[model samples]
Target: MKFDLHVHTRFSKDSDADIDAIILHAKKNGLDGFAVCDHDVTGGGPFSVQRAAELGSDLVIIPGVEISTSEGHLLVLGIKESIEPGLSPAETILRARAQDAVVILPHPFKLTSHGIGYIAGLDVDAVEVLNSRCLTDGPNNKACAAATSLGIAQVGGSDCHVPEMVGISYTEIDVQERSLDAVLDAIRQGKVRPGGGKTPKVFVMRQMMKNAQKRTAKILGLD
Candidate 1:
């Protein structure tokens, strides 16, 4: 099955894609499932799954969270409780693993997002080698190199903040079942392939402008 392993929803504060639109676009993109890795939040899991059911859609919404670790960002799937942010990457991975979660290094070379540079020595379960949000190939290629050098699993996702961007990048995994656990296990076992083109430059600019406007509104108490 194909899954966009990293994505965001309104719960992230920096994102605006609602559960309904996320499901709609995932189906439109021919995806079998997706994970909502809301930044520093872990409450979107059951909500997204329930909403998909309500819409009569069979898309699997995996429970996941994107942790803002002190070193960088980490996407952990198959875990529900929110791990406190700012933990070192190793500590974060330990906590996620305690829950049998799949730990993924997202945009591991993007400086602005705090991509930690030494993932090849970390105990991560996977590396996001194809993030749609990465404009230049440098970051993505660097991630790929690290994954290759370290023999870590590789995956991809849109890391999208808006509905239209969902599934712009994804992972093709080998799973015998269509359940969440099956997908997570597949990723952890390295039975996955990264796939996706870069997100359009226009969409990237639009997201940046939107974020800027939101920040301004919040500062002026107009949000």
Candidate 2:
């Protein structure tokens, strides 16, 4: 099964992707499933799942969150509740584990995007070695190398904030079933490989600028 394990929707302060649009585009992108991992929020995941069902789409919607840990970002999958942000990465992982969640270190070397710098002792279940939002492959390469050195599972995600970019990058999982449990279990056991291509640089830049504008507007109380 092909899955984009990181995505954001309007539930995220930085995104405006509609759940309905996201489901439509995911199907168009040939993805079997994708996780709604809105930054620091957990609501988008369930909302997306419900919306998919309403649309009669069978795409698997894994509930997840891209937590803003004290060190950087961590992707916690298979969880419905939000973990408090700003905790240490170790502490955050512990909280996710308590819920039997699968934790992934996303863009671990991309300091500009809040990537957790050194992943050696993080105790994460996987490392995002292919993030489509990366302008260059340097960060992704470093993440891949680190994961390889640490014997950690490697995964990929579009890190998309919009519906159109849904499957720019994805993790191909070897699963017998297309259910959420099977997908999470596959990732936990490292039965996955990163696939797909990077998002175009122009598109990535446009999205970044849009997010910046949104933040600026909010800061000025104009949003």
Candidate 3:
């Protein structure tokens, strides 16, 4: 099945896109499922999931959070509470594990955040080898290498804040069911595949534009 595991909504400080808009974009793009992985918060999941159900879309809205760690950004899926950022990566993973959530490293080799190299020693469930926002091929390759060396499963996502970018990079999983447990099991069993690449210049430019937009919005008090 095709799934975009990383997404953001207005609940995230950096994104203004609401869940409904994101869902509509996903449905139009012909995605089978998507996850609403807001930063540090899973509050948007219930509403998004309910909306997806109403639309008669095969969309499986998985609840998740992208947590900021001292080392890097981590995607915690199947979470039901707000996780605070600024914790160590290890600690963050531990907490997520306690909740039976899947802990994944997002853009592990990116320059802005702590990469997999720093958190390799920590226990993690999966590695995001192909992040839509990862600008450099090096980091994406590095993520693949890390997952290969560690014998961990690899997953991918669009890391989309804008609705149009959803499914740009996606994960293909082999699972009998479409529930959260099935997805998590697919990751654990290495039954996942990454299906895209990103160029460094394009990635850097996109981040710059997004940052500029956010700054402009804040200055105008539009957020």
Candidate 4:
């Protein structure tokens, strides 16, 4: 099954994408499943899963959250509740594992929030080698190379905050069962491949501009 393992929704302070709209778009775009890894929150997970099941009927919604650690961002998947943020990446990964969750290093070289600086020895299940929202392929290449050198599994996600970007990058999980736990097992067993094309430059640039605007607002205490 195809899964875009990273996304955000209205629950994220940086996103306003309606949960319903994102699932609909994912269906229209031909994705079988996706994870809603909103920044620092999973409050919308149950609602998004319920709404998508009602709409698509067979689509899968893997409860997930993109958490901010002292080191950087981590995608914690297959967990139902929010994992506290601001812990060191080591502690964060350990906690996620305590919940039987899967951890992925997302956009490990994408700079600032998207970058995790150095993850040389962190015990993570996968590295996000392809994040469609990256400004260029250089960051993706760096991530892919690092994963190769580290001999760890590599995956992909859109890291999207908008609907149209949902499946621009995804991971093809080789699981016949199509259940949440099965998918997590697929990731853990490295039965996955990073798939999908680049996001449209226009859309990528637009999102970048939006992030810049939000950052500016935050700096000025306007958000």
| Alpha carbon lDDT of each predicted model | 0.89, 0.92, 0.78, 0.87
Clashing pairs in 2: none
Which pairs clash in model 3?
A: 71-114
Candidate 2 C-alpha error for residue 121, in Å: 0.5
| Candidate 3 positional error at 196, Å | 2.9
Q: What is the C-alpha RMSD of each candidate to the true structure, in Å?
A: 1.2, 0.9, 2.7, 1.7
Evaluated against the true structure, the overall lDDT of model 4 is: 0.87
Query: Model 2, range 71-109, lDDT digits (tens) per residue?
Result: 899999999577999999999999999999999999999
Model 3, 1-223: lDDT tens per residue?
Answer: 8888888888887777777788888877767788788877778787788877787767888888888887668898888777799998888988898888878878887766456454367677778889877655788888889788888778888888777777878888888797878877777677888785443456547767888898999999996
Best by TM-score: 2
Residue 182 local lDDT, model 4: 90
- After superposing candidate 2 on the true structure, give the runs of residues whose Cα lies further than 4 Å from its correct spot: none
Model 3 residue runs over 4 Å out of place are 113-119, 199-207, 216-223
- Over 46-66, each residue of candidate 1 has an lDDT whose tens digit, in order, gives 799999989999898999999
Off by over 4 Å in 4: 215-223
- Model 1 TM-score is 0.96
Model 2: residue 52 alpha-carbon error in angstroms: 0.9
Task: State, as a TM-score between 0 and 1, how close model 3 is to the true structure.
Answer: 0.87
lDDT accuracy of residue 119 in candidate 1: 76
